[model samples]
Target: MTPWILLPRRVVSFRMPILRQAFALQALHELGRLAPDLARVRAQRSLEASLQSLREACLTTLGMELDTLTLFDARSVVRLFAHAEQARILAHLMDERARTLAEHGDYVGALSDTVYAGQLLACSRQRFGVQRDAGAAEALERELPKPGP
Candidate 1:
């Protein structure tokens, strides 16, 4: 687990980028579905880039001391929770995107996204508590292709 320290000054920094990436991913999904083959490829690449960025933002806030959050002012703690919520939303979005990718036969990319989203969901459970997203994660896990013997 990476050691995380959440300072008051650092609280507001991550929200915008993560939110922006989430929106971009949502937009790219629509474009990827409707665009020409070449344009679809470009949209997929851009979506991947946005997903990576969002993952990094979430990673930075994970592994923090939940007890230590009380040491900070209330505002910082609220911001931290908001950031975690944003991460949760993006993880679900990624899971949806992964399902689309799987339907289109991009199994490798689909698997990667599904696994990463599961990790994010697990981290959310750890950082907070039993989240409502557990069932969704289980559904995604079941959707993964079974390995060949």
Candidate 2:
């Protein structure tokens, strides 16, 4: 009788430009998550250049157009920010088709943006304070939703 042996499958690694873009996008998302308010407006504004920087980084690092590469589908991206109140402010800034306060020469949109930004800032500060007082890194973790088992 011949002995039979199972062989491990060969591991293949391939470079994916879209994955890189997705990672960069995730970094941007994290920035938004960590600093939802205008307290870091300057830092957030710098991210406005990130989209272009991402494209350039892709060309230089991966020889690809990161902007052209679709990482997260539209629905997924929308869902990701759906629960975030600060996203309304970001949406106004990011949406090219959306009307702007400047376009209408009205203060209402700008005022709303400012108000939302303040709310986000307050929420972040409160969370930080809670974590600091509780002396537990996991304190704020409970405030977040748990993933499905």
Candidate 3:
């Protein structure tokens, strides 16, 4: 007979932090879409707080513990799904952050954030077969500063 395996309490604790981070970031993204100039300072503060919580969760939980581990492993399938969803949430958040930064005249920061978001989307495609629009990333990439002579 097969045995029933249970997840560790520590791993279970990871869910709420992940859910909170996702919700917070999603709200920031929605706000940016609705009003770019308005509420940006609040959005920035919210993003920073959520990211701090996310950082702690990643350290304590299994989040990003094994970037070397591929998504094909059956044991990590649940984590893979959870992380994929987080990636989507984070990509949107970073995209909105980039827009907000650009609006504030922080071009370099905007480019950096935009690039990171693109990388996350690329990873999402590899892990979860979720291919977001590449055109958006490319459009932002074009606006990045060119190499100087």
Candidate 4:
């Protein structure tokens, strides 16, 4: 009689073009969440290169465009790899923007952006199921140290 042996099989997961685009968007969003202030500060120049790289990677790998994937739609994806430090950075940046606007006498704009920032921070926390940390919204508010009169 001959002895039989079993071999393990490897499985591969395939990602579609749309899915790749979604992933890229999620990456960008997370980058924003990680360093919101840096993102805003270098919004035009810095991120462009990385954004272009993602675009090219998607196009070459999956043949798709990045714009079709919206940030809201990418929320769940972003949460999967959320980094607490980055999220905190983003919160701080948003708070800074709000403060700057207020100081410039643009109360309405300041309030609006501040609210938006808060919403983003909340979404990140809720989605990632992360406990509020030192860099969270509360910390951001206190540390912002808004300019005085």
Candidate 5:
């Protein structure tokens, strides 16, 4: 599979599986940027495993178990229209994964996951007309470090 960074920015699709992969790639890219030397090497290995799970989710009909929940359900009734709820669930999973990464000293990966979680949440709201939750994306915005001087 092509590495996420090599994929063109405009190539990302609205499809749920594709979006999940794209976000995963983006988070991995950020991990490369922000993690320290030893941590970056360790995180690359860890995140690669996560990416493989995401790849399997994209390719298979069966759901993949992730952190106590299955993020993909190809048979769901809602998938007939759009994967809005799926996206929301994946966003929640991303947040949880971020915490896990942070606990393992992959803070850059955690930040990237949180930011993309917010993006995925916002995308779900806009695309499927899901009602906005007041507490959702705002905290992610707060977590983003301000621009450097």
Candidate 6:
């Protein structure tokens, strides 16, 4: 009698999980710059580890579970993968955060977050638009930062 072993087949994903996590991490780092206290707590953790960190920090930093965090915790959602629509959503959230910060006497923090939120808006526009005409492109070029010679 011959014994046979069967191998299971599974479809491979087009994108790698690590790449997804890297992108998420980059987004989180960028957004974290807006929420300094939150950023400081999450600085050392990787995106893969962040959900768990959030769970842990829930009690320690936030005084609630990660799942319990709400719009008041908008910064918590900044790590999500975003396209044009999500970028718009994040930009609005940041705008709201800036207002919140300004009301709380964090004027510098509000300004920094507002700038980052504007960057997010630019990201959204560039993602879904047609190529700019020469004049529009020139205007954008004048406004956008250019590398120093």
Best by TM-score: 3
Q: What's the lDDT for all of these models?
A: 0.48, 0.35, 0.48, 0.46, 0.48, 0.44
Residue 65 lDDT in candidate 4: 46
Please identify model 1 stretches exceeding 4 Å from their true place: 1-84, 131-149
The clash numbers for all candidates, in the given order, read 0, 0, 0, 2, 0, 0
Better of 1 and 5 by TM-score: 5
Q: What local lDDT score does residue 149 receive in model 5, on the 0 to 100 scale?
A: 44
**What tens-digit string does per-residue lDDT give for candidate 6 at 1-149?**
22322222121243455555445344434334334433333445443343354344333422334444333334333333343333443554455555556655679967976887776556445543533223323333343243334
What TM-score should be assigned to candidate 1? 0.35
Candidate 4 per-residue lDDT over residues 34-132, each given as its tens digit: 343333443444434534543443333223343332234334433543354334444344455565556556799679757765665666777645664
The Cα error of candidate 2 at residue 94, in Å, is 9.1
Native-referenced Cα lDDT, model 6: 0.44
| Residue 67 CA displacement from its true place in model 2, Å | 24
RMSD of 1: 14.4
Q: How close is candidate 6 to the true structure, as a TM-score?
A: 0.35
lDDT of 1 by residue, 1-149 (tens): 23355554366576777765465344334323322332334346665654444343333333334224324543344345433453454454456557656656789978977876666656666654564345434433443333335
**Candidate RMSDs in order:** 14.4, 13.4, 12.0, 10.5, 17.3, 15.7
Candidate 2 structure quality by residue, lDDT tens digits, 1-149: 22322222121123344454354345334433433232233234443443453344334422334344234333333333322322222332323111233234446644654554344334433443544323322322332233334
Spell out the clash pairs found in candidate 6.
none
**Poorly placed runs, candidate 5 (over 4 Å):** 1-81, 132-149
Candidate 5: lDDT of 77? Answer: 21
Candidate 5 lDDT over 1-149, as tens digits, reads: 56676565435443656765455444433322332332334345675565444433322311434432333332232233234544544564566567657867799989987876777666566655644333223432343333334
lDDT of candidate model 1 versus the reference: 0.48
Candidate numbers, best TM-score first, in rank order: 3, 4, 5, 1, 6, 2
RMSD of 5: 17.3
